[model samples]
Target: MASASLKAPPLPFLRAIAWLRDGMYALHRRMVPGHIALLELATAGYLSQATCAAAELGIADALAEGPRQPADLAAAVGANEDALRRLMRLLISAGVFAQRRDGAYELTGMSQALCSDAPVTLRDLLLFFGADLHRKHWTHLSGSVRSGGSLWPELEGMEFFEFADKHPEAGEIFDRAMTSVSSLSNEPLQAAFDFGRFGSIVDVGGGRGSLLVDILQRHPSMRGTVFDLPRVREGLEEELRMPGLTGRLTFEPGSFFDSVPKGADAYLLKHILHDWSDEDAERILRTIRAAMESEARLLIIEMVMPQHHRPHPGKIIDLEMLIQTPGGRERTQTEFGNLLSRSGFVLTGVTATAAPDCVIEAHPAW
Candidate 1:
């Protein structure tokens, strides 16, 4: 029986087969590390979608107090117990949640961001991005890329702002998201720039007065105005009620395309110019120019697009502009200089902040 088994294969033949198997195993070992990274990258969209689902279900809010079993959580949120358990497993692995030894889940620091009462809650922001309309429009991103135009008009039968105006719920979420994002940028701006030098500053297109309110609070000597369309200016009374903001910060309702309030030493265009085409941006700039004195400064607070070799948040946001706005885009230094010159201002300097955004200073061309 031992001789019969030994005769099954020649020694050289068996060695050749073993060698081939070893070579294949070696190739697999080498390829697996790279393949794992690529797989994670390729499947990243699923993670985002899952996160949106969790936010929509208010899982963070449910887990606010303590850990809970998957069944209890599913019952609380009206989700499928098994499916929610699976989702929680993935989330726990992703660092959004933590799994306990007892098979319950708890909120981690990352999941705290989705809690409704968190200082800077991003729940609404997640919901807004994962909303049906936004997701539907994103499906046409390829169309936008090919046409060099946005899918906003085609998707909603109007511009994004028009759509938001028509939908109060979406508008509220969008406004809240903007406020959350702006609040994050406000501190870096306060640290980087000296707003105390300007007697008065007008925040053109300031929505809900968050940034202006923050600025006025930071600079006791500076009085500020928050200017935007009537719809955007609505409900800002609550925002203006901050302790020292009574007489310091005020609202000015109007359109940037038409006119911005005059007589302010500095006009602030925070995250504004990136929302329109060159023609529209120039028109808005001209309106500000008409309202400004030769010595008045234009402080544009936005992300300065960097060179293409490295990664930048502005570059990703520029693609967002392409998806939502007709010709809106983040600009490089040269682009900013050109736009400022055409709009009757000189690009004086760009001050970097701890945040990715910068304070681009310009003076009216005398």
Candidate 2:
């Protein structure tokens, strides 16, 4: 007779968990190289921030033509030579500056981006997001996770916008940061969608009107209106008045929560809805829906999260929303479908922009 032998059946739950674990681990392993780069870049904030300060102080601009000794550079910026040398040393290691045999410092490619004279200076964006506002407010990220609320008010003793309004420097920094981000999306979006079909485009909650300007500039046939709070309108007006964009763009100071100016062929809300909760988002969407001109299409430019286990960068950006906004995070296509339906619009499809974000297009219900 054969001795009794034991056999085991597979556990589905255990199998599923194992699969998930392996997937996430594989992703992490693959991401490790990029992760290392990001970590090194981020940890060198001293160099980054100092570079911003130098840009603000015209250090890079001063070094544009040639290298300069520490003594001369520091004197120009009103700093001590020894201390300035130390700062330059840090930046040199980060590849922003190069050291010469004579102890002078010269600019590098990355340093060029930090220069105020550069056609596109990330200087303003870096100085704003990398310093006081980010430093103080980012500290409350843990609090945001614990309560699912904004850390701005708790950290700054006032809401984010309010604090920015009261502090002009902060406001400028905030506006510059927003403008920089919007500029990145503008061209990609212009190429992705045809604005020539629409006569009037309304940009709801448009900040600085950078994207609006880009779209109008690209599609000369289109005229646009920017709708936002008075403060944001101020920033928009600032951009609109700069010679070229004047006649092409108009500014309407109002709230998205109230009403978006009607009579537009398309209603554009880029980077807006994600700042609000489902309830508030629906409210805003309904307001826009009610005001939509007959035959108007609604385009929402936003980051879309993947519905399945597939990895996407929006997951990290969702955490940024969690820490900064009250009740906002990225959502999937199906979730957006429901959101659009609740607001009286049916999502037709998504347009992939040249930028990393996607434009979800919907039409008002007939």
Residue-level lDDT tens digits of model 1 in 229-281: 88876668776776777888888888999988989999999888998999999
The prediction achieving the highest TM-score against the true structure is 1
lDDT of 1 at 32: 80
> Over the stretch 272-292, how does candidate 2's per-residue lDDT look in tens digits?
888778888999999999898
Residue 62, candidate 2: alpha-carbon lDDT: 80
Error of 1 at 86 (Å): 1.7
Q: How many clashes in each structure?
A: 0, 0
Worst 10 residues of 1 by lDDT: 1-10
**Model 1 TM-score on a 0 to 1 scale:** 0.86
Positional deviation of residue 212's Cα in model 1 after best superposition, in angstroms? 1.3
* Model 1, position 275: C-alpha lDDT score: 88
* TM-score for each of the candidates: 0.86, 0.79
